[model samples]
Target: MRRLTKIAAVTAVMALAVTGCAKKDTQTSSASGSSDKGGLCASGGSGPKIGLAYDIGGRGDKSFNDLAAAGTKKASEDLDATCKESEAAPDEPDSAKEERLRTLADAGYDPIIAVGFVYTPMVTTVAKEYPKLKFAIVDGAAEGDNVTNLAFSPEQGSFLVGVAAGLKTKTNKVGFVGGVKGPIIDPFAAGYQAGVKAVNPKATVEMKWLSDQADQKAFANPPGGKTAATALYDNGADIVFHASGLSGNGVFEAAAAEDKLAIGVDSDQYLTAPKDQQSHILTSALKRVDVAVYDFAKAFKDGTTKAGFDVYDLKRDGVGYATSGGQIDDIKDQIDSYKEKIVSGEIKVPNTL
Candidate 1:
């Protein structure tokens, strides 16, 4: 019966592809027979087929999308799965996103993962047509029976970063640069502001968004980020935390040239930035999207994964701060203490804009 069930699942997937229900424009075949060697495939059968659609900035931003990719890579390595990825244009419209999701689905990917909140509508529309097909959306939630929404409580980590920035700033002034003013970018700014106020009530936090709410070019505009960082530094901000995606690279460059410090988000960007400018990195507010993706893949492989909204927080080690290269040693103890308070319920980090 177990063998028959396994065969049935594979047949269903192939049948869906043959019927042209899901239309794909690209397809690649590998001679390597499916095995559990890489763990992308399940034991005693071919691996699961996974698809990932990256956000506007794609990979290499050293932030949200990269972390999601890391998780997908891990799943591919450990679960014996076949993984496919697509990069969307930054200004791609909803129709393009919908077509991409359908293409991946038609290509026989069981669980097509969308890496950012921007893919919410696309995922929702695609998920409805293929009831048996699984879908995962990161950084945002989709309300559908077949979709699993993975969300991170970034404020929990941002609060800790704010604490670090507050304690380490010699000039008692810091700045926050966001990619744009939106539901996603606001949490980082709000949490950092709250954290700064918690430590130094008088510490002035200079807040700037690279673009207004209507500016669609916000996430990928590196020059704007650099300009914002320069303006902030000139305005007397000794430390800055940026949640600006690829634009944050410009912030790091500006900080390095001006001999100031900057905090990274989503990943440990100290390594992503130039080696010479690493000294300017204070710490990073980490969002463990990779872990979530890996866990979801494992659960799907084991037939234990459920479809719903899965929220990860500091309690589950899903979000926190990163200390690497001795950049945060000066205030490590303080950061740890704050972590304890948060874990022990003494500190409640607010999740709001």
Candidate 2:
């Protein structure tokens, strides 16, 4: 459900001097001042001008990036704010993200929101240079007097979905597919395994990562997600949960092809999935990035944005499991009970394996 990523190997990706958006017109700002109806900030926002930097795979991933975009939409309506956006290129180095931030700042965007931990260092370094422009990073540990770090308790939510799989699996075998192998993604696996074991101590969890440190496109490869999930299903897992970003698409595909159930991450994927595949999605572990982004936008507008962590935990309703498809309706009480225990400190879900 999140990326509390350890330091990304930015130095590993050779720096590219290319400074434009992964978008067609990287420098173009879609302001509400313009009459473009499809513009991101079209809600008649009259507040701060925001610069949003999306992680790789951009807005249509139906996972992480899409969730952040939703927050932007809500901000435009509620805070009367406007925003310009830039997207990270697959496997691009930190230099590109830095340029994206600088471009936004140069064009007068304030309180920039960088969507993932891959941009953490760049935000930390760039915020120092801008001094006055505020920044909020989702899942990043970046720090500065003007930067707000918005982190979510994905592990807590993962545990609840794990309960669903444990309760629903006919084969007593489940699967977990993470986008990458790192601290950021480990919590998901940890929480899921814990939850599964909590309900069925002997159940097996087939764990796989689409990419390791050697590969940076971990979050972008849908084919890899499909392959990994297919193997898990072939190996006897009746339900699969994927915390891989865009790659989770393939996981859904695999679920549909195999006629099995799957759990989605970061957003209510059941709402975003293809019609034929919707029924295959049992639930999604919600990271609520939109909620965090809206909270940040509101705080920034009111001059109350916190400098340190803005945690979205179970207690804060920041992270939880979604029940949109009515698939989990029968088990809602069981799931909520676990959710309450975590919120009440009776259940200590692990954030690491």
Candidate 3:
């Protein structure tokens, strides 16, 4: 729950200024001023206008973006607020991101939320331009007094799920599929590797990345994910855990086809993937992005929005592993024991490999 005083360098991408207008207009909607959408206030009542700029694959990702949408959905219903959303392109430029933020700010939307780390530079530049508007960035840090950085300890959650994979792997061979190789995903690899080593020191963890960088369409590329996961499975990896965004769908598909186990990330993917694939999902590393987004939106509406750095970690219950399939039920007690140790400061999950 402690706020990060400084953001560790996750990547070396330079910040670029958007000199002209951003191309393309995203879809927008007014969630309030309609039928009683079930809120503290009646319908047709106006409230804060919220805007969300999502990363690649947006809502249907059934992963990170969808989880973020769950938060906005809750806000629109509970706070009776109007909401609008935008999606990022596969090879979106820095200016395009900046333009998206600027468009929302200029349209009088307060407390705009940028859903991924790629928006850090854009958030920094745009927050300065719209001094009065509040902005929040997930998975990365942004400067200025008007910006709130909503980050989570993803490694911590992935570590717990790694414990699950280690416990359940009959073949003693598992795999990790990363969306893109960088500091952003290093924690997942590091924590998962450590967790597997912790439980089964001899277990082999095959690591493969879909893309070398963020703009290579790795997170949104399902075919690439399937290929990577299939290779791992065919090579005798019985359980594969993925930190890719929409690309994880391919991992799940591969798992289902091969009758292998797969661990999900960001959301309870067992509930999001196709029904046939649900049985193959052993667990999911929960990032609770919905909670962060919802909490920030509520705080902004209540006039309690704090602009600065904030982090949600294990101690705050912001990250953990999900057992939606009950596949880990036999080891539930053991997993909780590890969770307790993490929360009690007995275990330090590494953030890099």
Candidate 4:
């Protein structure tokens, strides 16, 4: 794969400074509690109050929650909404989660977004308490008249990544590392397996599910991911696709150290990984949580947003790959070709194990 030229050191610093300034501005605006802006969500006299609750991993993982935060920040900036967020500490109690929801509802937030599947039950229960308030949950479904569930077809994006891995692997051997063995990550593994089989009928894919859900420590343990990746590579699997959240960081590290390639999930992790490790990152399978949040916020602002399930797939450009860092250029043409096949019904990506 062709590596994009690195920005000059001074330019990189300047860029970081500018980003820091912008984040500071966003934090200041959010902190000020003003509601006059009209970008994504509307406020009633005090601006729209948008509340977000994160899963156990919290923010700064450079993955799912961070992507969702980008959307919330955009909504805050465009809609002049006051955004409030809370992180569920690792292993938070059910009562605490409920209390957090009630606190946000009591504070008058119109649409409270629960960031992951873990928040489904809490969101469903809270929506019943605040019947007039709207709620959005990503990666999970919540049952209520006021709740809107947003889910991404990662199976679709993963299928494309599977195609890339299938064509690019010289060894004809690939691997998958999942955070947990559950409904959320299973589609990624299943679709990847299908994609690999599509291109290379005889290619063997080594599958590893990091979490059995028997031990609660699976998804957050990077050392475990590193050990798993090392084992996969030792078994002759050269390219690995990981949906392990923070644990996926260890997969990248192992790949970089071993001089192999790895695929990322949720965000454009090529930018998040160390520079020396950039070459090992082939591409990322992106689920547009940011776009979903932004669109729904816009709907709420316009009074046209509906309640119920909203599913985003490749056909809608809601789930796809990232082009940033120019990391995907080497295979760009191939990626486009596969995308067309998928969109035209020539290809079907499986959604289950």
Best by lDDT: 2
Query: Candidate 2 residues 1-353, lDDT tens each?
Result: 12234322110000011121221212225532221224566433468788888887777778777777778766776667777878776667768789888888888888899988878789989999998889998888887999888887788989999999999989999999988877678778888888988888879998998877523458888899999999999999999999888889999999999999999988888877889999999998888888888888888889988787777788888788889889989999999999889988999988777
Q: Pull out the clashing pairs in model 2.
A: 21-26, 45-80, 46-80, 47-80
| Local accuracy of candidate 1 as per-residue lDDT tens digits, 58-118 | 7666777777767765665566565766777656578988888888888788788888777
Where's the lowest-lDDT run of ten residues in candidate 4? 7-16
Tens digit per residue, CA lDDT, model 4, 40-157 = 2223324457887766565666777777777776676667666777767666677777777788788777788887776777887999999999889887667798888877788888
Cα lDDT tens digits for candidate 3, 193-214: 8888888998999999987878
Candidate 2: misplaced stretches above 4 Å?
1-37, 214-216
Better of 1 and 2 by TM-score: 2
What C-alpha lDDT do the candidate models reach, one value each?
0.74, 0.79, 0.78, 0.73
Instruction: Give lDDT: candidate 3, residue 31.
Output: 35
Q: Candidate 4: global Cα-lDDT? A: 0.73
Estimate TM-scores for all models: 0.86, 0.89, 0.88, 0.86
RMSD of each: 10.3, 6.9, 7.7, 9.1
Q: Which residue pairs come into collision in candidate 4? A: 35-47, 39-78, 39-79, 40-78, 40-79, 43-47, 43-48
The deviation in Å at residue 80 for candidate 1 is: 1.0
Candidate 4 or 3, higher lDDT: 3
Candidate 1 vs candidate 4, TM-score winner: 4
Clashing pairs in 1: 39-78, 39-79, 39-80, 40-79, 40-80, 40-81, 41-47, 41-79, 41-80, 41-81
